[model samples]
Target: MPNSTSILSPIDVERIRKEFPILHQQVNGRDLVYFDNAATSQKPAYVIQALTDYYQGYNANIHRGIHTLAERATKAYEATRLTAQQFINAASEQEIIFTRGVTESINLVASSYGRAFLREGDEIILSGLEHHSNIVPWQMVAAEKKAILKIIPVTDEGELDLDGYKKLLTSKTKIIAVNHASNSLGTINPVKEIIQLAHQLGAVVLIDGAQAGAHLPIDVQKMDCDFYCLSSHKMYGPTGTGILYGKKELLEKMPPYQGGGEMIKEVTFEKTTYNDLPYKFEAGTPNIADVIAFKFAMDFITELGKENIAAHEHDLLLYATQQILKLPAVKLVGTATQKVSVLSFRVEGIHHFDIGQMLDARGIAVRTGHHCTQPLMDRYGIEGTVRASFSVYNTKAEIDQLIEGLERIINFMK
Candidate 1:
């Protein structure tokens, strides 16, 4: 067992766990051990209740209606935008644009900003650890504009090769799109340094913060990124709601992502004008209730504090990695020096699918696959891995069970 002192100070664990109600549950006659947090975290009661309260009490369309219900809903929904701005330490509420999730947010930038700015022979640089959402959109834009897409290679330890990244940047580079932390490997990229380097080369930077949202401290102003994307579901909020934070000047300059109501200032038969900043990107009716519910998730995190949460989870990662690495037949996939709570590994002489099935039968949930990072998997010369990711609610006792489970599977297979 991991030393409790090293894992989390006792008070911190108790206080953090109390906020997440779903942490107390049973599955298959056993206490639930949720290690699949990287996919989507289980929502706290406060977040769920917020969603219910909004619909039950004040369910109405926002921005256009003058009715009392609409006014209430509008205030609630817009309140989330303000909360999100503070969540990421963005410059203003106008810079925070709501979208479906990280996928839609990235697509918005690729289609709207890429279309408006990119021309032939321009270059877009991406790291090897990007999720498919980040990669495909750029590929689409590159093909459309005849722009070049360059990849930054990954080291054997699953960390970005910063030297290789430096070589890829050039005067013609239009955008540098990379993830803040790799979903598959849990490798935390040096985004501040990456952004600084990209900016020196005259490239705008967009960071995919899907994996980093709940785990890391995000300050868009401090990071100096041109754009940042985050998903609400990954942060203990609703599934369909997410945010995109862009610099005010850049958002003002970019064309509207989608054409519809709420995004226009004025429309005439001959000419139409776009609304300022955020509305220009949020075209039609958004997932309003989810957006409203997302405020609770943000509040939950804020109350507990991101630094404290990260410290607790960091202990879980260290404990899990130490235990898993001691297994003779186990081969860890990502060994980056800096990482989140993801523990991705492959067992010798057994397929990852088999390992996952056996673990699931023991009432332990984990994600097993390329994890939407096919290019990263290909680069590492592996088909997939079994990923056991951690969250703040997880305990050292759970990590011990996971280690014991893996040991049994390896011995049985042998």
Candidate 2:
């Protein structure tokens, strides 16, 4: 059963702001307006405390030792798998595999699943809006396996061309990888439709949910995706820990991603056997402290309710976009009908890096440049964009400050 809870209005913005202690500070003698959430969200106090408590209390290497601390660490670490399973509404906890982040998660699939199943002449379809993490791994595997890479073209509005995507699907298309939300553009792709179409062509699909995990409702079972990737840091958890959710049957078929201590069942001079299910992909000591703290991050979202969070962030997006678009010499880069709370744009004749620096001087934090989507930037015929992404704790006041800063920058530059 799905983890059902009463939908509450996204926490009172004032109270939510207090939860994030970092938001209370001033930068450059001005209040900090953090707009770099699409890069990595600021962690709440609870998440921070969880990390501290783990290290100060039950810090130990997990799964191998028979000591009490080791047992406690193992239980706490594995509990995060359950939380992630529920967070994404996956069918089973066995599907969650911890990794460094979304990049490693995608690479795991490309190296293990791609190497095991993909062959020469097989085609892998990707969207034009993919982050480098999603694009490069497939390129490496496709090149090595002699498979072909095809892209679902993006429309002028920064959306996947579904018509073109349909035309690209063929019997030889074995895999389809795309982001649930474009980190650079904040365009939320219709992943369910994308997955369903790929399945019809007998192609396995992977959805990179790095940007969507905290802002959108993700039900992997509902989407029926073969693989799903997430970054905990992007979702208010610590860095260096995330999840890769693969369907049980597909995960069983894929080979281990790396060889290390915990992933082995039995090893000798002659032969070695691998661990089962999730552990097979999660090798080494693992990010135990952050993984434990990640559960708190998931709980943070669950308590607030995704619907409420999305509604609040959507308001910020609308308000910010309206205000920013009204400014002189500013043109929005992405105008997708559906998007997260991201506003990506370019100012006429103003270098994005300069705009970013000016914004920072005023204590505003926004991401500028290709945002790890260089190919997507090339598609738009631009070098990069100034991206302001909103999170649950952000308020309309912050957007107002951003607009004021941008207006000043635009006027001065003009």
lDDT per model, in order? 0.91, 0.93
Per-residue accuracy of model 1 over 231-313 as CA lDDT, tens digit each:
99999999999999999999898988899999999999999998887898888998999999998888877766777778888
Error of 1 at 196 (Å): 0.9
- Pairs clashing in candidate 1? none
**192-237 per-residue lDDT for model 2 (tens digits):** 9999999998899999999999999999998899999999999989
* Candidate 1 TM-score, C-alpha based: 0.96
* Model 1: residue 193 alpha-carbon error in angstroms: 1.0
lDDT, candidate 1, at 239: 99
